[model samples]
Target: MKQTDFVEVKQMQVKCVLCDQIEDIDDDALQAKRLRNRKLNMYLCTPCNERIAKNTKKRHKSGNFHLFKEKKDTNDYL
Candidate 1:
């Protein structure tokens, strides 16, 4: 007679929005929890996230970056 047992592992598969890279995340991880709670749907791999940050800093230093403020129409009858 013999006894065998196996434990199952939990993994969440996520795709990177920028490079479309497929990666697995531990189900108990905070990022996975956020996704499960629908806080954010987009996922970016480490490389893509870093690249964007680097480029944004360069653009900001070059004075070519701009953030447009939203215009709101005020009620004319005041």
Candidate 2:
């Protein structure tokens, strides 16, 4: 095909910040688009994500887990 078509169809290469694994994602996928536009959303491979979820569940079961939630200002109406 044409050079422009080839450029548009190219895959995006991204590295997982947590596991340092390089992965190729489709250029048109939603994840790819989010990563391209948002700086705070990092890529995590499936394995790493699953492992983290498992560990979080385990911690929750131990009755000592705490999640820090940001407090909203109470004086905003003043």
In model 1, residue pairs whose N, Cα or C atoms come closer than 3 Å (at least 3 residues apart or on different chains), thus clashing, are none
* Model 1 backbone overlap count: 0
Which tens-of-lDDT digit does each residue in 1-78 have in candidate 1?
Answer: 334345456899999999999989888888889988999788888899899889989987665423321122233333
The weakest ten consecutive residues by lDDT in model 2 span 65-74
lDDT of 2 at 76: 48
Off by over 4 Å in 1: 1-7, 56-78
lDDT of 2 by residue, 1-78 (tens): 998766767688888889899999888888898998895389877788799889988987664423322122334434
TM-score of 2: 0.54
lDDT of 2: 0.76
The model with the greatest lDDT is 1
